[model samples]
Target chain A: MTAQIIPSRTAAEAALAEIFASAKAGLPGSGAVEKLREESFAAFARGGLPHRRIESWHYTDLRALMREALPIAPAPTRERRAALRKAAAALPANSLVLVDGVFAAELSGKLPEGVKVTSLSAALAEDRPGILESLAAAWAEADDAIVSLNAALMRDGVVIDVAPGASLAAPLHIVYASVAEKPAARFSRSLVKVGAGACLRLNEMSLGAGGRAGQTNNALIVDVGEGAEVGHTLSLTDTRPGSLRLETFLVRVAARAKFDSFALVTGGGLMRRQIFKLFAGPDAKGTLRGVSLLRGREHADTTLFVRHAATGCEGRQAFRYILDEESTGVFQGKVVVEPGAQKTDGKMLAKAIMLSDAATMNSRPELEIFADDVICGHGATCGGLNADQLFYLETRGLPPPEAEALLLEAFANELIDDIGHADLVAAYRAEVAAWLAARARSETRSVA
Target chain B: MLEIKNLNVAIGGRRILNDLDLKVAAGEVAAIMGPNGSGKSTLAYVIAGKEDYEVLSGEVLLDGENVLELSPDERAAKGLFLAFQYPVEIPGVATMTFLKAALNAQRKQRGEEELSIPEFMKRVKKAGDMLDIKPEMLRRALNVGFSGGEKKRMDIMQMALLEPRFAILDETDSGLDIDAVRIVADGVNALRSRQRGFLVITHYPRLLEHIVPDTVHVMAGGRIVRSGGKELASELERTGYREYAEEAA
Candidate 1:
């Protein structure tokens, strides 16, 4: 008789098994959706949590980093929702709120004409046509264990749809806030569909209450229709020291469509934000940009996979990171041009500035081109702040910290200044200023 | 107003200046002319307190106060300035914002009230006009994409705005046309006062024709090999630095 060898389960795998067993029966969807969930969970179980063996996850070893997983978070109470509403009162009227992964109708206000917003769970419960299909369309293409885990465990999210040939006057802001007192996990997924000849502006934000080790696993899938224009901005701010966040974005741009995205990651304990952008049709254009500010033992990773599958398409990416204290920043970007993708142009650049002796940065920019007549290039640079520049500012009568702040602002402003929206630029500049002020205050505290 | 006594400086473990002694009195412009590799720039950097240069032994006194113990900004607050040979370009910091910040920082350090926006703007406009610097250039990033002449003019404009008590011009005339040099010299002359001192470092005597230094020093090897009036610049231009180089060797 041959002995059968069964691999032992890791803590993450065991935790997933327990969560899936408890939530599967109560989860939305049946038939195809149910089968997709089962298959995705089985796939996740087969591979377990992604570790160093996976090339994409090499820099971020989730198996070792995420040693323990917290239990699923419960829905926020009425009082909690009220407090969240009060706190988020500063947001624009055309905004939606997601508390602890569940879409809060009480917190959401009226939307403009020609725009429809609904909860994912509600759509699944009512068996809305094409809802399950849209959710399952990108499941197999994600090709990451963390994404598969999100697909298996995602309970609630929002579905935003813009009518054909329509345009929204104001940006649609979606705020995700975690208000759990104890350590917990929240899984959410959002799907956005911009119709043909339509235009939409989508803004997303993630925030966590201080003093708790919370886990947030979020995913977004965006489909840009033919000749549509979509602008998306994501901001992650004020996360707790023990928070772990993993976000994935799957974007597909159609013929003559335009997709513009910018993400600012300023606060987190452990974060890995991955973006998969595919130019699926001819003459499509995409610009993906990001800036990350890390400090105090934080580890942040931004990985991108830009694929040009059609001819006459162009893609550009620029990412910059500012790391301080003992923090670690990572950037892994790949531009791939498939066969027959002639006249494709792709460019990528990643730069980092280390502010302390213990700070570390890892950047890898790669290009894989199979087409004969295509242009693709990438560059990465990692270095400390220029000593001569600092000296120049110092000699002009500014103190050391103030001079450093000015230089760092200048470094980040190159990207921030290109943002087309004036309001968004101002908002991001304020956030940067706040972060620098906080850093200066912390330095003073440590010195004292 | 500015004095360097027995100054010894080494950079990267190599002696660049040895027992250098010089002084610039109030209202006087002292010019240092030297050949390549003569440690002229090192003296300017040491006076400004650049971090990499090791000051083994020195007493840099400004108005009877030892300035060697101060940081670069502290030295600036005490009214000292150094115009760089190669001005550093900061890509996103606007020149106007930098000027305002610098002027306000110095004023605050000296316990003076900050200038109002209109007042600061008027001052900058006057200084810009004097230096022939367009207002649009002031709105651009500091030194980024500036031509050689523009960069030199910008340095002179900064000096005009700051109005320091002691100024050191390190090769400010290196990358300039005749017109630019004249404009820069005119800007410096406009700021000249009895309480202010100037130390001009150059390789050629062409700049001395415009600034008209009271004292000229020929530096070779590490220390001053010759010191005389403005006539010394013309003499060096006629005979070249060969004799001074041989004498120092």
Candidate 2:
């Protein structure tokens, strides 16, 4: 397994320390939360940003991916901000629109009944301190550098609360559209707190629309309450078709909570680290499915971490990628079982199909277990379509190119078939098939 | 007519077929009985234009045209078909959709319009029934997860749909039971016409009894060293390719 993260950023480090110092100096609190934040900030100061040396962040080299200057906070133009509204409107569910790391309330649609949606800004104004404090407590340790950096850079996000016994008819779609110039990195933070026995379906669309700098990143945090079920599907990519994006999603499930997530990635010039996480609670379920179809200079990275912290919880992750031309893909999934988290079942598999020699894929699937009674496994496979299989199709008279596309489609079909929603599955299948067909045509044209 | 004249082939720098020769007239079925490594399957693949099954020498002529210049689909459009012994189990390529594509491709090459969904369904249903394959089989990925017999039957069903002028059955009877063999043989017999030819390649001679060939050739050491009437199959059935292989060497 190759490690891609390294830490040596003095400039970014100085910026982080100043941000933490301000956060400590201007503590917002009604109770002991201020002291906790001070302590977490101190830990952050000591640990600094996590490098690849830390086992948790093996594949995604955040330090290298950051490259040049981190774009300072800036308001994207109103003209370009239309993409946020447009994406939100296309969704068939209640939407929370966030533009350039800031939520646009008047631009968003009406919230569904029994759904309590509040901006992070509004929640802080009322001094409901525990919600924000608990978030820092659960996800960040001053020792956890990335979480602290996110905390320091955190801006406007939506907080969704589902009342007890409520089940949403339509899934909630949170559209985060980045309007910043090229290299615009939008830090989008979302916290979903579902009440016990509540069921919710959420769709997330992460778009780096028309950004010049070529990269945008968003961070989302979701917590499924006890016995609540949440399904989140993300159609993630950049608007410019050849732009790069870095996104991180942190999801936590409570006792009896169920979480299902699907990520369909296309058209990112350089995509880094869309992470799926399940901080296990008793009987909690987490299933992650992702597919990245990239061509040209596009790059997609899917990294998953599922910590089995409670007993009888299930964690499953599957990611497949198709890369043509000079596109690149990276998939790294790790499943960890804490001691006494027995009966924790986990399965992670990463499969990649490279259509051209110029395209590249890096995959590492690993399992860490401390509990003896757990059933945990991981698999990673990378290759082109099987010649024997293709020959079989060819003899059936599907030419080589068509046969190759059919086999690649079949690779994604396995994951698509597992998606419970029929219509959504069909749409994704059609989209992926078309993407593969276009590549097939291009290759054939070049050959001819 | 299909003819192989001094066909020489190799794979990964090693010779598999050397100076091979055979012929099958239109409307006639010829059975090639050979032992493992006798290049029977290699011959079929070379004719079908499988990647890396290079033609080092000799020529394969179909209807008086050298076939070595054609691609797989081109060969198929030119009235040549090779029924793979080990049918690929493609996961997403629906059996019926693939059949339609193959059929339509051949039709388009012949200047005919593509089949509509309804027309395709009707034709596939008839062909499926003739091969004793259920309609559900057509809905599934082409031959994926199918039994060996089912895979062979699906191959025959596709062959029936294409209705090519020449067909090569490479061990189509290798994995089938007596009943599946009979059903497959009956389907092929039903589709036989004076304008088409078939070269059935198999290790065992049992298949020749039902699809009784017009001629039998014993292939050994990559070439056919013996040819005779249909009764030759019974002789090889009692003995084996060992004698013929020794004679060829």
Candidate 3:
């Protein structure tokens, strides 16, 4: 008889399993969705947390890094919701706010015309037509344990629908805020649907207080309709030192449609942002760019899977990482050109700068071109700041800190400039500047 | 005024400068002419506090205060400037943005207020005109994709804007055509004042013809072998550096 031995689970894995078992019945979703959750949890439980052996999660061993999963946070109270509403009032008037992964309608703003917003939990409970199928289909090709866990536990998130041919002048903003004072966990999944010929700009912002130590798993699924133009930008700021965050961006671009997304991660304890994009129809264009500023033993990983599934499509993925202190950054990008995806033009580049002796960066850019008549390439570069450039700037009277900041800014600006929208560009720039300023202040304090 | 006393420098344990003593008085344009491998560029870099070389034993003084202890930017705040032979290309940093940052940083260090945008632009325009640095060039990334001549011209423009008390032009004419050298020389001459000092490092005598130096020093084997008037440059051009090399040996 052959012995069937199971590997031991990490503390986090055990905690996650117990939490799921205790909360499964109360989790928002109908019968089918509940069954899917059970199946997804089974899959996750069988695999355990992603470890170094898993090729996709090679650089980030969640099993080892995640010591224990905190209990899932309950919905915010009235006072917390009121505080969030007051805070939301300070934001732009077109924002939808979520607190601890749960939708807070009172804290949200008035969305633009022709736009319908619903809570994802509500959509799941009501068994809204096509919601279950769409949610189940996202990242279906990749058996990612984290995504499955999120699917099994996702409580609430904003679901946005833009009508066909509707053109919105201002960008719709979605703010995911974590306000827990103690250790906790939040799982949220947002879905965005843009109708054919529609134009939409969506900006997602993630904010957490510096004192809160928690775990957050968030996913954003976007479907760009035929001939639609969509731009999405995500900015994550003020991450605490003991926190952990994993975000997923799953996108599909349709025929002749254009989809562009940029993510700027300034501060995080341990962060992994994974992107899965598919060129679903011919002549669609997809561009993904990101910049990560990491320091203080923080680790940030960006993994991408871009599939050119149709002919005449174009895809570009570029990312930059600036690491300081003992921080580590990882970029693993894979581009797949399908057999029938002829004339597919795709390029991927990852660049990193190590600002200290201990900073580390791992870059792996892979291209799988099954199609013979396609153009695909990938490149990676990792280095320290140019000494000559620093000397040149110093001779021009800029101090070392300022010179370094300027160089880092210039390094990230290449991708930031490609964001296209002027106001959004300014906002992103301001955030970059703010991060630089904080670094400078801390450096000064350390020196003193 | 800038002074180097018994400046002995080395890199990777190999001596590059040996007891090199030189001075550039305020209002004087002193030229250092040297053969290849004579450490002229090393001297310029050492004075500017570039971290590559080891200062075995020396003192770099600006206004009688030792500057070897100061950082490169601190020395710049003290009105020291080095025009690189090969200006570094900093991608994505617009020329205008760099200029403003440099100028304002220096000003702030001197306890002076920053220039207004209009005033800063006016100064850039006036200085850039002398160097023929087009407005569009200033809009592009700093020195990125600039022709060799354009990079040198931009260096000269930065020199003009910063208005340092001591300026060292390290092979500023190396890759320039005659016209470019003339334009850059004109920019340097326009910035000359009694409060300013200049140290021009070059191998050939061509640039000296345009910006005539008040004093010329022939550097060989890391030390100044001969010091003379402007005629010395022409003499070196005619005699070549072989004799000086043999003399220093």
- TM-score of B-chain for each predicted structure, in order: 0.98, 0.96, 0.99
Clashes of each: 0, 9, 0
Better candidate by lDDT, 1 or 3: 3
Model 3 lDDT tens row, A210-270: 2267899999999999999999999977577888999988999999999999999878689
Across A42-78, the per-residue lDDT of candidate 1 in tens digits comes to 9889889888889998888888899788888877767
DockQ of each candidate, alpha-carbon based: 0.81, 0.57, 0.81
Q: Rank by TM-score, highest first.
A: 1, 3, 2
Native-referenced DockQ of model 3? 0.81
Give residue A273's lDDT in candidate 2 (0 to 100): 59
Q: Which ten residues in a row have the lowest lDDT in candidate 1 chain B?
A: B240-249
DockQ of 1: 0.81
True contacts kept of each: 0.78, 0.59, 0.84
Off-target runs (Cα >4 Å) in candidate 3 are A207-211, B245-249
Clashing pairs for predicted structure model 2, backbone only: A5-A61, A43-A142, A44-A142, A182-A212, A182-A213, A183-A213, A183-A214, A243-A269, A244-A270
Q: Give per-residue CA lDDT, model 2, range A1-448, as digits (tens).
A: 9997644556656665665565444433333445545555565556565546666555455554444435544777777766656655675547777777677886678878879988765565465756766566446421245555555455667888899779988778787766675455555466787888898888776544565554454667777888988887777644465454656788888888888888788774566654647655788888999888888877677777677889999888989998888988888777778897999989888888888899989887878899999888888888887888877666656666676777788787778777677766776788677777777788879889
TM-score of chain A of each: 0.96, 0.84, 0.97
